[model samples]
Target: MEANELLRKVRKIDIKTRGLSQNIFAGEYHTAFKGRGMTFSEVREYQYGDDVRDIDWNVTARHNHPYVKVYEEERELTVMLLVDVSRSRLFGAVGEEKREMIAEIAATLAYSAITNNDKIGVIFFSDKIEKFIPPKKGKKHILLIIRELLDFTPENQGTDISVALRYFTDALKKRCTTFLISDFIDTHDFTRQLQIACNRHDVIAIQVYDKRDTSLPDVGLMRMTDLETGASRWINTSSKRTRQAYSKWWYERQQSMSDTFSKCRVDHASIATDEDFAHSLMALFKNRGVR
Candidate 1:
């Protein structure tokens, strides 16, 4: 894309996502993702309902009164977005390409993180680590990230979730709330890495998919290319057997994906290309809050 066009799209996404982060998300994001731990704030007079363990006996003895050490949730946290920028992200038969949806979703998450006074970072992957923006705070940092999300292109075209997850655990020393956004179309098994990462940090999976990806239209023979491998083939989509097989494959794939998440205890939600992503996101946040 041209420089001017990229800037325009980035600005457009910033406006929409920033508004959602501010108005729609509001306290939901904070409530869903609590801090890693709490920090001591100050000492105050012990109240009737205060926890007895918090009583500062030294201060009580010196002042001849019961004083409790006040602590607040350490709101400062780091949010990491592990984004898949593979070839499949360009596929869509609906409102927007998967890539476009991903850019918007990443921007929204980044903006939401900033609203909670947290640091936001991103890892763009395409069978490898395409780029990594170190966690940082401020609107300027978020804008830069949005700009990169709009314009940064990857060198490879394949999908490998394991590579990305491994890099995330190795590079980021501190535990963080991480969002892994992708279509979950990987040939390699990354459940082991995902389980390991979840042990160290809170990880959420946001699977973006298109309705057409699950079925085929009866439009006779159609030529298709494997975006990741660059292989081309012709399929007789009008055949009942072909369509049935494809539909069955999709169902099994979805079930396996759900099982992987359940086995690892990872929170996840799937969003279709034409669906109302805002509602799905709100639901996911609400679910996490209740947990």
Candidate 2:
């Protein structure tokens, strides 16, 4: 894309996603991901109803009066967005492309992290690491991330989720809340890596898809191509049996993906280009709250 066109696209995404982060996702984002732990804030005079266990003996002795220790949740945290920028993300039959949706979702998450006074970072990857924006706080940092997400093209066309997850685990030593955003069409056993990552950091999976990806309508003969492999084939979409079998296979793929995520105890949610992503996100947040 040209420089001006790229800027325009980035600005457009920023406007839409920033509004969502500010108005809709801010509260739920904060509630869904908790802070590291409580930290001592201050000490105050013990009230009659104050818990005796909370009294600070040293402070009490110094002041010759009982003082209760006060602590607050350490709200500062690091949030990482591991985004897949593979060729398949460019395929979309309705609404925006999968890559576009991923950009918006990532921007919203970044803004939400900044809103909560947390540091936000991102790793854009395909078969290999494409770019890494170190965790930082501020609107500038978030906008920089948004711009990169909108414009950063991947060097590879294939997806290797295990490589990305392994890189993330090695780079970020501290515990963080990591959002893995992708279509998850690649092959590799990430269950072990994901389980380990979850043990060290909170992991959430946001899987993006298109309705057409799950089924084909009776639109007669159609040409289909694999974006990642560049393989082309003609399919008789008009045949009912063909469409039914294709739909069944698609459903099985989705079920297998869901089952894999479940086995790893990872919180996963799906968003289709044809559906309202806001509703899906809200539902996921509400579900997380229940947990």
Candidate 3:
């Protein structure tokens, strides 16, 4: 994309995502992800309903009055966005591309993190780590991330989610909330890596897909390309047997992925290219908040 066009696109995404973070996700985001712990703030006069254990006896003795130590939640966290930028993200049939939806979701999450006074970072990965924007605070940092998300391209075309999960687990020693955004179309088994990552840090999966990915339209023979592998083939979409087999394969794949996530104890949500993502996101947040 041209420089001017890229800037306009980034600004457009920023406006929409920022508004969502501020209006819809502010409270739920706060509730879903909590701070590290409470830190001592100051000592104040003891109240009748105050916890007796919190009483500052030393201060009370010195001041000749009852006082209590006050503490506030340490509301500083580092959030990471593990984004998949493989060539497959460019494939979409129902108006919106998976890449576009991924970018928008990432931007929304970044904005939500910043709103909570937290540092936000991103790891863009294809078969390898394409880029890593270190965790930082401020609107400027977020805008820079948005620009990169809009314009950045990957060197590889294949998908290997294990590589990204391994990198994320090794790089960030401190515990953080991570969002793994992808279509979950991997040939490799990432169950072990995902389990390890989730054991160490809080990881949530946001799967973005398209309607065409699950089934084929009954329009006779159609040519299709594997975006990640660059392989091409023609299939008879009008054949009931062919369509049924394809749908069965897709369903089994989804079930297996769901099983992996369940075994890892990870929260996840799936969004389609033509669906309203806001409701799904809100539902995810509400579920987490309740827990």
Candidate 4:
């Protein structure tokens, strides 16, 4: 991508996602992903409903009146975006490519973090860690992330969620909220690693996919290739049995992924490229806030 073109794309994302963060997500995000703990804000005179445990005895004795300690939620947090840059992201099929949707969604979350005064970081991975951006708070840093999301190309073309999670656990010592954004297409079972990571950090999984990933139109014989494995094969799509088999395989895959997520106790949402991702995201955030 050219320098000017990249800037333009970044600007476009900035405009769209910034508005969403400001108008729709900031409060929900803050409520959903809380800070580490509460911090002492100030002391105030005890009210009728004040908790006796929070009463400042020393201050009370000094003033000869009951006073209580007041604390505010710690507002700062470090957020990590665990993004998959595998080759399958290039497929748009019926709508926006998974890669493009990932960029937009990631950018929205980054901006939402900014609104909440949290530091944002990103880890791009395929078969291995492609790049890591340290957590930092600033519009410039966020714009840089958006630029990378829009333009960065990976050296490998595979998916390994476990490898990325392992690397994240070792790299970041503090327990922070991490978003795993991917298609969930890896053949390897990473349930063990996911469980470990979720135990350490607040992990949320967002699965982006294309409609064609689950079903195909009976448009006659067609040839297709696996994006990650580069294996090619011809399929008789016109045959009803072939279509049924493919659909059944897709359903099985979804069920397996759901089971892994359940075992890890991680919150997750799935959205197709053609669907409205904002609604799904907001629903997830609202669910978390209520929890």
Q: What does candidate 4's lDDT look like per residue over 129-228, in tens digits?
A: 9999999999999999999999999999999999999999999989989999999999877888898898899999999999999986899989999999
**For this target, which candidate reaches the highest lDDT against the unseen true structure?**
3
Residue range with the least summed lDDT across 10 consecutive positions in model 1: 94-103
Error of 1 at 197 (Å): 0.7
Tens digit per residue, CA lDDT, model 1, 1-291: 998998899889999999999999968999999997889999999989999999999999999999999988998889999999999999989768888888889899999999999999999998999999999999999999999888888999999999999999999989899999999999899999999998899999999998989999999999989999999999999999999999999999999999999998999999998987888899999999998
Which of candidates 1 and 2 reaches a greater lDDT?
Answer: 1
Instruction: Flag regions of model 2 displaced more than 4 Å.
Output: none
lDDT comparison, 1 vs 3, better candidate: 3
Off by over 4 Å in 3: none
Give the higher-TM-score candidate: 2 or 4.
4
* Candidate-wise lDDT, in order: 0.93, 0.89, 0.95, 0.93
All candidates: TM-score: 0.98, 0.96, 0.98, 0.98
Over 143-256, each residue of candidate 2 has an lDDT whose tens digit, in order, gives: 899888888888889899888899999999999999999998887667777878888999999999988888898889999999998999999999999999998988888888
Error of 2 at 165 (Å): 0.6
Which residue segments of model 4 deviate by more than 4 Å?
Answer: none
